[model samples]
Structures are given as C-alpha cells and as structure tokens.
Target: MIEVKEIEKKYGRKKILKGVSFTANKGEITCLIGLNGVGKTTILNAIMALTPINKGQILIDGEPLKEKTFEKITFIPDAITMLPQMKIAEAMEFMKDFYTCWNQDRATELLGFFRLNKDDRISSLSKGNTAKVNLLLGLALDVDYVLMDEPFSGIDMFSREEIANVFTSHLIENRGVIITTHEIGDIEHLIDKVVLIDNGLVTKEFNAEEARENEGKSVIDVMREVYIG
Candidate 1:
C-alpha cells in the first residue's frame, strides 16, 4: 500500500498541492480525478518524489519513500519521456539497460499488444500510437505499483478504448495503480477507488462498487455533487 499524508507543494509563490492525502492499496486501482491545474499531477509527482514537497509523508508498504522503493513503483508521466528521435526498439534497449526490473518478454508482449513496430520512430508515430508506446514502456516494467498521469488525455476514441482494455487484461492485474485523469467515463468501471480533488484539496474518497451498490451513484453522479453542487 502507498500512503500520502498531508502533502504540500508550491511553485515559487503559486501553491500547487495544498494538504493532499490519499492511499492506494495493492490489487486495486486508485484514481485521482480533477480538472486541469487542480494539482492532480502534482500529487502523483509528490508520490514519485519527482517534484519536491514542502510538507508531508509518503509511505510505500509501511516504508518511507527511497531509491530502492522507487524500483517497486513505476511512474509514467503525461508527456513523452523518451527521446523523440529514438526508435521503439532503441527505447526498449534503453529501458532494459537502466532498470534492473525491466522484463523483455513483457515488453515484447506489450509491443505486440499495442500493435507497435520495433523499427518505428517515436517521432514518426501518430499521437495515439505515441501514447501507446508510452503506456507500453511503463506497463512492461516488473513493479508492484504504477502511477500514471492522464493516460487517456489527447487521444482518439479507439486509442482510448484500447488503453482502457488493458486495465481489465492480465497486464495490470493485482498491481496497485494510481492514475490521475479528468476524463472519467472510459475507466469508470475499472477503477476500484476514486479520490476527487478540487482547488488542491482531496474532497472525497470512496470505493467505486460501494458508491454504486450501496449509495446508488455513478462516478459522474458523485462528480456532479462534488464539483457542481
């Protein structure tokens, strides 16, 4: 499990995350839902230690965040991390050389799953294909947790559907996943927990199933109450 307690962050004088807190458990998908610039990505960055925090604690399976702990958690940012000029195969080799946990078989499988060609240049691929490559790079890693920032953003409908299919597939099973996105419809059924954020604060956290079966609410319904009402 990953626990984030009272995290605070600022960029110069502008506050990004103000008292953000949440927990992501193993074998479940925890989603951070909010509008753009509400610090959703900042919260994920804090969890990965990619961005410095002003105040807070982040724990992974009861241990404080550290270099070794990072090995067990994979973070895929929204932007393309790989060099634009690099080919897909070269990017695979780069990941293999850097991370001890890199799995060649899994990478190969995802390459086929995403219908991506090894010889294809990252810069030459379409926007949707580029997103798939980004996703494949992260999902191929052998890790206990995955943190994704806007995996569904800026993609075509078919690409979005393909990516969402991955959630139900064995690729993501039994691994704790924390995804931040404002587009909730595509993944509404796959997520186990939803943490709603607004104005740099976590406004609500609840189990998705309980919200439907017990409270009779869909994710969008809850969103309307939180953001609209």
Candidate 2:
C-alpha cells in the first residue's frame, strides 16, 4: 500500500500541488484523473522522488519512502528517453542487468503481444510502438508499486485495449498500481479506485464498486462530471 499525506509542491509563485492526500492499496488499481496541468504528473513524480515535495510524506506500506525504496517502485512516465541507437533486444538486456526483478519471459511475451521485433532499432519503431516498449518494461519489473503517467497517451484504440488487458492480467495481485491518464475509457474496467485531482487538490476519491452502487454511474460518467462539468 502507498499513502501520500498532505503533499505540497510549488514552482515559483504557482502552486502545483497543495495538501494532497491519498492511498493506493495492494490488489487494487487506483487511477489519478484530472485536466492537464492540474498536477497529476507532479504527484507521480513526487512519489517517485523524481521531484522533491516542499511538504508532506509519501509512505509505502506504512513506512516513509526513503532512498532505499527505489527497488520497490517502478515508474513509467509519458515520455521516456532510451538509447535511441540501441536495438530493442539490447535495451531489454540492459534493463535486465540493472534491475533484479526483471522478468525475461514476461518481456518476451509483451514484445510478441505488441508485435515488436527484437532486432528493430529503438529509433525505428513508431511513436505508439515506442510507448508499448516502455509499458512492457515497467510491467515486466517485479516491484510493489507501479506508477504510470499517461500510459495510454499516444496509442491506437486496439493497442490500448490490448495493453490494458495485459496489465490487468499480468499485474502481481499483491502490489499496487497508480496510473495517471486522461484516457479514462482505457482503464474504466481495470481500475479499482478513482482519485481525481483538480486545482491542485484531491477533489474526489471513489471505489469502483461503491461508485457504481451509490451513484449508479460508470467511471467515464464520473470523470466527465469531475473534470468537464
């Protein structure tokens, strides 16, 4: 489980995140949703320690996240820079050496699912395929927490569906996934909880089952009301 308590961050005079608090429990997928620039990515960065917060604590399983927590967390951002000169197979081999949790069989299966050729140069793959590889790497890492920022940003509909399904089925049930995405439809069925941020604050949090039972609305409908209404 991951608990973010009263996180606050600022860039000059503009406050990006203010007193944010949320929990992502194991065996559940919690989605962060909101309009662009509403601090969704900032929250993920803060949790990953990629961006230092001015205030508050980020805890993993009741313990505050420190430098040693890197092994427990895997982050996949919207834009990732790989050695564009390397081949797909070479990149996988490099990551396997770097992370103790790297799963070779899972990586191979993901490559096949995405129709990615191992010998293809990283720079030669299309934009969507590039994102697929990024996603593949994160999913294959055996970690407790996976934070994905805009994982569905540029993919086609069919690939997006396939990716979502694979993520759901392959994810370790004992771990947690916190994903930030504008494409709510892609994860509507997969997510267990929704945490919507707006104006730099957590404006909404709902469980899929509770929301459906109490509000009689789908996740897409709730999202429209939260960010668009």
The prediction achieving the highest TM-score against the true structure is: 1
- Model 2 weakest 10-residue run by lDDT: 165-174
Residues 39-149, candidate 1, lDDT per residue (tens digit)? 998888888888889998999999888888767999998877899999999999999998888999999999888889999999999999999999988988899999999
Q: Cα miss at 210, model 1 (Å)?
A: 0.4
C-alpha lDDT of all candidate models, in order: 0.91, 0.85
Worst 10 residues of 1 by lDDT: 62-71
On the 0 to 100 scale, the lDDT of residue 151 in model 2 is 81
Q: Each model's TM-score, in the order given? A: 0.97, 0.93
List ranges where model 1 is wrong by over 4 Å.
none
The positional error of residue 58 in candidate 2, measured at the CA in angstroms, is 0.4
lDDT (tens digit, per residue) of candidate 2 on 1-229: 8999999999998899999999999778899988889999999988888889999999998887776686788888887547888888888998899888888988898888889999988899887888888887787788888899988887787777767776667554667899998668656878899998889999889998788999899987887787678
Per-candidate Cα RMSD to the true structure, in Å, reads: 1.0, 1.8
Off by over 4 Å in 2: 224-229
